[model samples]
Target: MSLNPPDLRPDLAPKMRLDAPRPGQPTIGMVSLGCPKALVDSERILTRLRAEGYAISPDYGGADAVIVNTCGFLDSAKAESLDAIGEALTENGRVIVTGCLGAEPEYITGAHPRVLAVTGPHQYEQVLDAVHAAVPPSPDPFIDLLPASGVSLTPRHFSYLKISEGCNHRCKFCIIPDMRGRLVSRPAHAIVREAEKLVANGVRELLVISQDTSAYGADIRFAEERGHRAHIDDLARDLGQLGAWVRLHYVYPYPRVRNLIPLMAEGLVLPYLDIPFQHAHPDTLKRMARPSAQTETLAEIAAWREICPDITLRSTFIVGYPGETEAEFQYLLDWMDAAQLDRVGCFQYENVAGARSNDLPGHVPEEVKQERWERFMAKAQAISEAKLAAKVGTRQDVIVDDIDADGIATCRTKADAPEIDGNLFIDEGTEGLAVGDIVTVEVDEAGEYDLWGRLPA
Candidate 1:
């Protein structure tokens, strides 16, 4: 029997199948960590397990075994993943660890040697095998069958659609390619069919994700349709017809990406781009093995804004990479000021063990990195505040995410993504409002990060 409990932890996977078991049937609990991409993997795993008649327990104590989908993107993330493993082991005793951190099984087994199994990212079959060995599924096809809605960790209104797997970029500081392997695009028809199913099942928004969305059709040679191949442009065109908000994420600023702008303008897709600029300085970008020509990119940004004035461009940058001089940091600041990007995220550099950046010269000291991070955040915050202040008078369409017991509703506009970006709060006129309702709100107040708006009486 399925027990649908609201997942309180935003960081945990949203689409979990918390099914209470039949007598003598094994139930598996999972603690999913890391980014939305990793969470998607967890969703896929749980979906497969559910199909195999393996019930999912919401808490570790009630489960026959637990799966910990981990993150190893940064040192901090790895530490958190390890802590989660310890927590699971302490609570349930039977734990299986997997994900990016699982790529290095020794690191995990060294800390928690009693874990049932450790497997790397995308090793869904191995994870199932481990689960079978620990808590085998006993299927009663008629009794244990799943719903047509499928297993999802996200809310019913939205879903993260991973169009491809892995990265082709060899950025010095990143090991995603190592952890998740090279680019592998799905067939166009397959993606569309999944998206169509999602929309048909009441998914109102689709967050398209991958290591590099711009590199989507490259691996598959773009042959997804009847000889048309699965290219992003075509994929966007096809998915746009599903009558849901299509938000593209992790798109590199490749030349081909420009082709997608017109779709946003034409109202086929949301006018939002979550690109990672990394660093603005040419020298720093070169050291990190990224595109260093900022001039053209800035020009392209201007051109994109011209094409779609309502477009919201979001980007992330690394502030204190190894060998990142003060001038380079200043260039980044200056670029931020000039670009006036709609949304921004900054990170101070952390040395991953196997990354080439660790071997580079002039690693910034920790104290300096921290100070630079403060300065970098200050600059971005000021820019964000100014940009948000400009939107105070405009009316925006907002999708309600949640409403509290006190009747206050929290919502997001097309420009605001689910978590990373800001939110819109509805204080008054929330009588008829409900989560997932799309309503018009007049921007009345703006803060450094969030906005306050209310519906018309």
Candidate 2:
């Protein structure tokens, strides 16, 4: 999980008197590592700090202390976390290592004695206590650590709103469950309240995220307990009422999720869905412990089209799993062509410890895996261009996100998620444009993936 620092409070007085040294306070810097979920957690931490009256410095050198939000989901992730720790140690400021990596911080503090604290999920409950004790307290009280139903991040015009936490999926290639635990959802009331807060803060586009968004409410079974049936679709419906463009990510294409397509067709939710299909070949998927039959998978996609004809499906595929045959790769390519999916991300399979796929037989060599990835991506690029070309002359409601000094404006349509998907680029000369304002734009040109357009007068 990657983390971003909390949005500073506009109300902070900038100057403050000193309190008795409580621990780690006065000046603060945060480095969040991993995915967007982790980023949200760090944002919450920042919200607490801002409430307490601390000045947040973007640079570590300027702060009295720094916090590193670490990721340990995979070998590469662990290595990156270690590198972050090394960099933190060299700085003169006191350091605190937190997050999933804090699940095991002996690797860090064992080498760096200057580290002030090593904390994990359990430890985080007392974040202010630990930080305050680390340094002398200033006039600012520590920020509230209580869960907030509000956003305190930057006014980026768009933000990722994580509705649930952790994963219940046991895909052998994944370590998410080990790192984040089983599915636990924040209550629907909390989620809706947070959405309102975000919209009030000028976030016009919301990306709903979780390890498996479809599984929301399953563990709680709020549907059964309250004698009222509620599902992810219901959650989406409630969030949609907040009057913002809502989108979903990491949705496993389960039958239950198919039920939400109709909900999405109603126009408040974007027609876009990001489901990680992993691989199209049944045997490869089984080895990864995804356990879905090939026919069932295709049927779900077919159902999506039947429910929402204009649906823009985005998916990720893994190439060269253990025991993958050339024929299996061919089947994947053929499926892509047949499906003609709108947006696709393909990654060469990387082996991670504790994943069942690593123990499976017939692993493909590095060179062959790289070749397959290249071939599939080349085909996907052409498919993307053709799809974009089909949109020329069509108008889309794009929320203005940023305006460059050169006078060009960058924005996103309902079909596009922030940062990962394509964007609508408008000429700088557009009048009365501001970030967070929605405007209609007609596609005048297209490239391989992006749509070029002009704002309506």
Candidate 3:
């Protein structure tokens, strides 16, 4: 996840202050880490504080306290989260920690004993109480009036719309179910209302995220209302009418997900799927405890492509599993050749604490894991090059994201998601173009992982 580690710095939070202000008002600075789900949690926490008349500081220097949202998904992430907490202590002196890593409060306080308080993941009330004890807010309506539109931690042009919380999967290599608990989806109306507000606030794209997007409303049993069920397809179709690009993430390849292909085909949603197919070999998948992995995914992919010819399948894989063999790894590479997935991410398996995979037999050595990771990445890169090369001379609609120091505009096609997937670079003919504007670009250059293009005449 280092590719785009959770953006915890206060710089990512909303630039506008929702709190009006009072004399000697308390200001809180936040540092969020982990996945988009965790990011949403941090946003909610800050929004609550803002409503209570606490000002959000974009830097730690002026803030009375800081909240360090941590990620405990991987050992490496845990170490980084600890380092962030320590930094908060050194820089601000008054610090409270929350997030997945906060589940092990002792582990954190053991490292940063001076932290003011520690709370577990998504414990909004506990976090607020901790902040109150540390630095109480002094609301003066003269300065701080609570606004209906809450503070966001993402760029105003785009926002992450988290549909649900937690997961029910028992993948042996994962401890998410242990930390986040079972799936609990929000009602379709609430999701639509939030998307409506975001779009009204000038958000051009909404990236729908959750632990298991395909399982949305499963726990709700597809409760019906106003002729729409609470399922993802219903939620997605509802969100599509809000005049913004709706992209789905963290979707499992459940058979029922095929119903969404028509929505993509009809331009209601982006023709993209972000599936996490951890491994290809049945034995390795079985060892990982991802029973759904044994499904005929290739056939499913073919059917999806048949429905939406322009669909771009993006997936992540775990290489060097505990019991992975040369044959099993080769099987993954061969399957990649057959799948021709548009985008891919490869991670070397590591023993995350509390995950069942840690004690699994046949643990590959560090050197072996590193070697396999390099080979796996090389193959994925080659595939990316070929896939992108095929787009040369093709014009694609792109949403501008950034203009680099060199004045090149960074953008993404419908096939690309923010931060993780590749981008298209616009080096010329971008007169007066701004971020979030959708425009067509003719592909002029293709790198292994990115493309260069320009506005057409």
- lDDT agreement with native, every candidate: 0.85, 0.73, 0.84
lDDT digits (tens) for residues 255-289 of candidate 3: 98899999999999999999888889999999988
lDDT of predicted model 2? 0.73
lDDT of 2 by residue, 289-340 (tens): 8835565777778888898988998887878788889999999998888888
lDDT of 1 by residue, 11-127 (tens): 223444354666666788988887788888888898898899888888887899999999887776777788889999999999999999999999999999999999999899999
Cα displacement (Å) at residue 301, model 1: 0.7
Better of 1 and 3 by lDDT: 1
RMSD of 3: 3.3
C-alpha TM-score for every candidate = 0.94, 0.88, 0.94
As a TM-score, model 1 comes out at 0.94
Q: Which rank order by TM-score, best down to worst?
A: 1, 3, 2
Give the lowest summed-lDDT range of ten residues in model 3.
Answer: 8-17
Q: Which scores better on lDDT, 2 or 3? A: 3
TM-score for candidate 3: 0.94
